[model samples]
Target chain A: MDSPNNDYLIKKINYEIKKRNIKKVPFLEIRNNRLQGVVSSGSDIRRVYVCVIDNNNNTFSCHTNNNRKCGGLDTQYVCSHLSALISQANLRSEEDEKFDTLASTTNKQGDTKARYPEVFARFQHYLKYLQMEATIESIPEMEWFISN
Target chain B: MTAKITLKENDHINNPMIFSNDVKLDQVFEIQHQLIQVFSNGFSKLNSKGIETLKEINIAFSTSPLNTLISEAITGLNNNQLTSSNFDLLAIVMASIDGSAYDSLFDELNKLMENQVSLIDNAKEINYTSNTEDHENFLESIKSWLIDLAIMGFTEINMDVLESFEQVMDTLENIPELMRLNVILRGFIEEITTEIPITSQDEFPAKRWLGLWLRSYLLTMQLPKENVQSIKDCKLKIIGVQKYSHDYFTLYTFHGILDHEGNNRLIQIEAKKFTINEVSNNELLDLLNSTHPELFKGLEENLVIQVKQGMISGNYLILEKFKTTTTSFDIYETLAVLFESKTISYNKQNPYNRHPLLLKYPVLCKIENITKDGTSKFDWGDIPIRFDKVGTLNEKWKLANSKGIFGFIQFDNGWWISPVTILGDKNQYIGYTYSQDRSGKNVYEVLKERSNAILRSKS
Candidate 1:
């Protein structure tokens, strides 16, 4: 079940983190063979983009409000949005959520669009942490969802 | 290095860090929960009980920051309803107080928790220190902190711990005995905090690190000599030979062999130190032998050999003597031995045992496009393995038509196999000048950086 094992994607994300000053990730998830998250833009506090990076297939999609595709598809380039999403995916992975990076991910080479709807929804749910989570007991969905 | 130097038994009582009692602790947790319940009900309905509870908790601890922050959080809400960011900050403060919560007090609640140390003492008697046990206690704290990082991952913790820990390490680094231990941990902090891990190569000396698990285990052993036993001679059909490398030097070679049921498993055994000082793989053949030399002729991956004798130390076998027999397996067959086995990691039937990192496996996978820059994933079973450190091409890749290749799959940030040799006309070994930095730093880098020193010197 090998997906993407932290090589190119992480390196690019690290560069983006420094360049964009992305100190607080707030929300991130690695599921269904790619790294995905809804990240709040540093410049625009109200703006958040649902970004995804599948290192195995070498493709990514950032459903930003614009039509621009991240440099992830271009040679030697990675989108800042996608980079922030993947920067901490491994660092944030919990125990039972153990996912093996799939070597057989070539099947997803052109199938990047299929994962967006679900990823976008997860991003919306993940945003709840920044709001008041008034419950006395810890919420299960907010389990790995950490904030400083 | 299980050399016992009995210190004191009541050290925990002598210098306690967690001083909050059960009753006070219960009150803290109770106050936190009620605060959440009140806040969760929303600020518009800020119940009197919740506000009173905040006042009570703030006053109870005599914690000034807590009192000021609590007031600032709710004070102006009625007048000008704070921004979502302010509400976010308040939520974080409330969540940080989640009961069973003393650990977080160090980071987010920095102004609160006490009991800190800044000592220069170099005493073997840790109990004698007033604030902190500058030697053994510091070592213990580091180990536990590392385990927490491993189990919880770096992102889960607040980044401030890194700065605080660096301060502690800086103060403790001057002690000669703690130098090696500090350097490794310091290397890890330097890498993981600043650079993302993408490969397993670093400036860390693997030659000293491979014995980490063995060292930590033996450190606690009371009957070190009694644990050493000998197996006269046995036939071992080698399953695989795992090599952990730093530069050109092979750090450690994990030899995977067949057990009685013919199941392949990776066993970690050092060439030395079983009892008082520990024995080697073949030392069991001698009643009181000092060293057991390893014979490597017949021990290639997927080869059969007759082991003349070996030592069984804990869960690993140290093969002192062995003869090369004839054997060969195709690529798929070899892959089956490496991955298809029921026990890829330590299990009940494994020759393996508990280890902090994953067992390195010998893997053969096709290379699509070798990472030319720092932005490509090296294909493993067609999946991409991120390789940021690309070494200059030293050997010929054109020799094999660049088809299937051989590499060692060990645990780094994730499971990674760094392709070292391509299956060419003959089995040609390839070389690369992998760039040494944070990305090239293996998760094992810090591992090598840490306890192998303390346990080794103490042993």
Candidate 2:
């Protein structure tokens, strides 16, 4: 489930990305229930990882390889690369919701999942090769990531 | 019992003028008899009334007749006619009189007496080359006389007596032959007796006398020039710099070692204190270096830093200065490098939670969107915050929470760090304020402790 302040987060991410002039956008894909990608600038590429936990009202835990330039994982605000990825994730989620509603209304057979062929193809690849796991539940969920 | 006075047939008395061809020798003898009788009677009265008689004599000496008589008596001593006994009587009479009245004559009599004593003691060596020795003996005699007068004056001092002694010393200082001797005596006495105890009542007069004496001595003597020359010739080395503060002055006392004429002595060579506005920074530094070379050397070796360039690359902060560059991944890395080869353990458990590096190098960080007036609009950045402006750590935490930024800021001209609330309405960014402890332990306190530890170890 998306956080209630998820809109605010999306807006903040967009603002930060625009302000920082983040040119190279990352291709975010969910793997093992974690959203991860490689953020690149020219020849330099930094790996970014984000995990959404159900506890703490659906908070996002983020980390970047370039901790110094991107700030530590424990930073209050995410780095520009992470913010860009988050904005993309929110847009993708909204598109998926719209597609789901359109398919339910238009077809009784429920075979309208392939409405956007490109998105369908990407989602299929994420499911098959990435081994994307369903969001699981633990008794006491991890509070925060300890980034080295 | 005719009260007849015996006349000595000395060449000075035989001069053909006063008792010459027209006047009888009996008239001359009668005149001498009357003068002797008057002196004898005066002495008897002086014995009966000491200070009163002296006062009366001072009055008489001021009058024309007695003044003339005193002048003539001084001249008689200079001539071959006056015997030592007669000179002694004349000196006694002159001692009772005011010296200022018969200044030149009295001075002449003093010189004649000095010369007579030298002649009697060292007559065999009486020549032009012995003039220096004679002058030295004369100086000794005058010094003793002055000292005796000073003692007497101090014993029964009144304003009048103090003034009289001052006048006598003043007159003596004016005399070219006695001037140097007077200076030496005054300086010697003052240098030795500076620590002497005195009653509150005596302190003022004593100090006045000393001040006047020293002023006259300095005015008349050329010793200071010689002393300065000697000092210039000596080798001076700075030992230390001591700082003292009072309401009016902040004094930097420079202690030094003086190697003068093969003698080594430690002394407080100079003290320089001026208001901040009164002195330039370069001048103050120069004075510090000159006066306290050793201290300056130590500071230059360790603490004195000239920042050429500071740049942040990734997590590494690079500082370039003194023809050398140093790079550290973070403040911790920098401090580790600084405290390198030392067995100091840093708090490495939660690295991102605290920034100890900001305390040491506040200039290394840059604040985004700083206004033209040099104030930051952001809640948190590397803004220069005054130490006094910083509230308590708990207070800072509240402000930081309100502003949505960490309480970290540079304080006290970047020497220390403190939790600060930026005084701007715009909350531009959500600054990192979270610490694992949840206690009031801010980054500043952690950095301060670590820096102090490093400093202590190095020191």
Candidate 3:
């Protein structure tokens, strides 16, 4: 009951990786009883991409880049983005501490995507990964960017 | 400070092969090669050339005994979606495909086949008079076959398992053992042979696999088939309807129960999928009056009618007379019939009769969850479980579902219900084909909305 463990994560999200075709995680943030992260898009790279989970209530949500309310809430039970976020989250408690029980998945309904800009700011790494931070550093590779 | 984080290794979570992505394309070819070698010379000789062809080609994996793997090889070979398996199975799959394409490989399988005559004789030995232990052993073997199909996935099961399954199914179909799970076996075969697709590397759904049928068969196998075969006339009230399609034709089988002359039976009748050009109830009634005045009362849900000179073929029924009883049945009654009769005794905890079908036939349902844009959702009893909305439920369904639906409902990749005409139901009965919607607006209105949107955008 301490926190989500490898066994629980695998049990909950194995299908997301195999069946839903989730590739890998792009970015994730794990805090007290919550996980927020950006998952690599399984189908489209430009898809709305953010995931949130509150272990306290086992409620979750997802959002587009603009933080518009999206399918992030819809896939709380079995979403690939949530799967990626949970798998990549730092759920392990004090290293040697063994724990049992998982965030019981009751599929509670609610969305907080209205605060997209505010909550979105919490994922500073996500903004960094999105290359939103303008760096004046030049790269020869920019000229070699393949359009196709 | 990034605390000393040690990620402990869990073998099941980490084993790549256990959670493998897919059978490596090279492995598929290798498996194909070894099987071809196995089939080259038939049972008599292994010339190393072998059974290199598939007897049938289909888009998905089947659960039917012999032809399933053969079709799987053709299907997966086409899609390159075969899951990982061991080397021996690779040989079997290739051989299965090869045998299907060219020779009847029974020459090889014949060695594994139980002699039908001897098998039947032994089965007879374990009759009602047989020891309890013998019956247990026999039933265990059958359950074992179910367990095998439940566990071994597509492109992974070996020939021996399939042969045993087929042999047991064949025996059960022919002998009195079928009396135990007759209705379930008929329905289950119809189900598996029709839909099931390729599965990935994961545990087979165990609760679903063991199934209500297994429980029912275990409970009811001891009961005797009532001496009601002598009944000259019987009413075939429908239990359920399933649709299957081939290249050209869409086929429908109406499976139902006939409780007549002190005997009860589960029987299925087949019909082709037909569209009614009639635009109203009066038009349909007129057509019935003109074409087949015998059905002047009109066909209702469950098609309640008494048939004379009816012949029962295995689990199927053939009719000579059709005199409409125009009987009225509740939706709950129809569902109860679909569930085995014994469970109607009622469960103490849940007031409703314990339905064996929590997943397949039973829907954890609430009505009016349909939408105008062709997406569908449903509420499960007290729990408002939201289904993942996908493409094309056809907005027209919302019209029917508004009053609540009671017919063949399915939860495949998409959710749909083919509303049936129950005599007593307040829900306005909509025929499977859209005849009532004369405006043509309601007919397939949202069928191609998504596809058209994609095309228009691309254009």
Clashes of each: 16, 0, 15
A35-114 in candidate 1: lDDT tens per residue? 66655555644445556667646666665423233334433444566555554554433321332242112323333363
Q: True contacts preserved, each candidate?
A: 0.00, 0.00, 0.00
Instruction: Please name the candidate that would achieve the greatest TM-score relative to the true structure.
Output: 1
Which digits, one per residue and each the tens of the lDDT, describe model 1 over residues B250-340? 1123344434334444444322111100111122223112232222333324346566776654335666676556664443345444544
Task: Write candidate 2's Cα lDDT for B176-258 as tens digits.
Answer: 44433333343333322331233342232332232233223222211111001113344333322323221112334333233
Q: Candidate 3's residue-wise lDDT over A1-148, tens digit each?
A: 1111122222322222111112344334343334555555456444435666656566677776654555535633546555555544424322212111222235644456333443344333223211112121111111111000
Candidate 3 per-residue lDDT, tens place, B189-293, comes to 433332233243232222222233233333222321211123467765654443332111223444455665654555455543112111122332343345444
lDDT of each: 0.36, 0.28, 0.34
Query: Where is model 3 chain B poorest over a 10-residue stretch in terms of lDDT?
Result: B345-354
User: What does DockQ give for each predicted structure?
Assistant: 0.01, 0.00, 0.01
Q: Comparing to the true complex, what docking class would candidate 3 get?
A: incorrect
Ranking by DockQ: 1, 3, 2
Interface RMSD of each: 23.2, 36.9, 26.8
CA displacement after TM-score superposition, residue A125 of candidate 2 (Å): 99
Worst 10 residues of 1 chain B by lDDT: B272-281
- Quote the positional error of residue B393 for candidate 2 in Å: 35
What DockQ class does candidate 1 belong to?
incorrect
Off by over 4 Å in 2: A1-148, B1-153, B171-235, B239-254, B258-459
